[model samples]
Target: MLKGLIFDLDGVLTDSAKFHLAAWNNLAQELGIKLTSAQLDSLRGISRMDSLNLILKYGKQENKYTKTQKEEFAAEKNEKFLEQVETMTPADILPGITELLADAKKAGLKMCIASASKNAPKILSKLGIASQFDQIVNPALLERGKPDPEIYQRAQQLLQLHNDEVISFEDAAAGVAAIKAAHQFAVGIGDKQILKGADYIVKSTKELKLDKIVAVFKRNNKKVG
Candidate 1:
């Protein structure tokens, strides 16, 4: 039986990924490099420095930037992201998320956030839903980011649940890989093709009902142990 629900923040609970993308795009403009949607998508569930590196690598211009310049550029992008997120409120919570959270809580499941975002706390607070989580695994605290399982492992540890007892929701491939690496059930929350590694894939959070989620998980596993 599932005892915990771990969610990814940017794409799962909110639409802050758009803000991040926009900020990165602004950064790309400043750097005289163009970031395609695919490139931006690849940056999901990674650190700011990793993202900047990916951008640099993609443009084959890593040799052109100094470490300090990279840091400054990341900061410039963050400023724009902060501006967009600062105006967010509860209304910014994605459709069906409020209800899903309430239903999960009522079912006695421990809820936590296992996001790669360093701004998880700030974003959750801006959405007026910071209190919704039992524990939040801050990316700043993790030595490695998603696709590295450490973040989800920390979240499971804090929730006091075994890996198999927790189910994680993610929209990014790296996020799914992390959850899977942690030995937890992974639920994908977007395009099936991109999110194919997930144990289960739901087109949107709106379509993910609590009962159905558990039912699906149970169906896939003969036993949780």
Candidate 2:
């Protein structure tokens, strides 16, 4: 019985990758670093600090910055990202997300966001869908980020639901890893190969139907049982 749904905000709900990329690129340019497209993709589903470390390492300057300096860089990037976020409107909600939220509400499923972003609430509100979620797990409260189960575990706890009663939607490999690690059903919303660990995969949210997802979850749960 899938009683709850956990969602990753960025790629899953709306495409914030452009905003993130623009911010990272702006910061990289300031530091005289050039990031490849592949490098930008790798930042998905990771914390701000972790992404900064990866960028610094790629630029061969990881050893050059103190923790405080790195924090400043991350903060600078976030300010730029927030500027983009501020421009978001309900029109920015991705395809099928509005339909999915309506369907989930109709089905009486509890919903929450389990994201690496500290800006989850702002993003959701800007998309005009903040009222749909029961909670948005605060990444800052967790000891670990995506690829670790802590964030999802915290979301599940907040939802007051058993892990087996939840299905988590994610767009990144790390997010799928976290969902599975938390003993929940993992529905990946991206390339199947990249999110191979997921119990189910859809190329995009537009393909998601509540009834179909429930059917799949039950079948998979039975097999696991």
Judged by TM-score, which candidate is best? 2
lDDT tens digits by residue: candidate 1, 1-225: 689999999888999999998888778877788888899789887788888888888888888988998899888888898999899898888888999999988989999988877788999998988888999987787798779999999999999998878889998999999999998899999999998999889899898888888887887666643
lDDT of 2 by residue, 1-225 (tens): 889999999998999877987898889889989999888788899899888988899999999999999999999999999999999999888898899999999999999999888999999989999999998999988888789999999999999999999999999998999999999999999899999999889998899888888999999989989
TM-scores of the candidates are: 0.96, 0.97
Q: How accurate is candidate 1 locally (lDDT)?
A: 0.88
Candidate 2 whole-model C-alpha lDDT, 0 to 1? 0.91
Query: What value does the lDDT take at residue 176 in candidate 1?
Result: 93
Off by over 4 Å in 1: 223-225
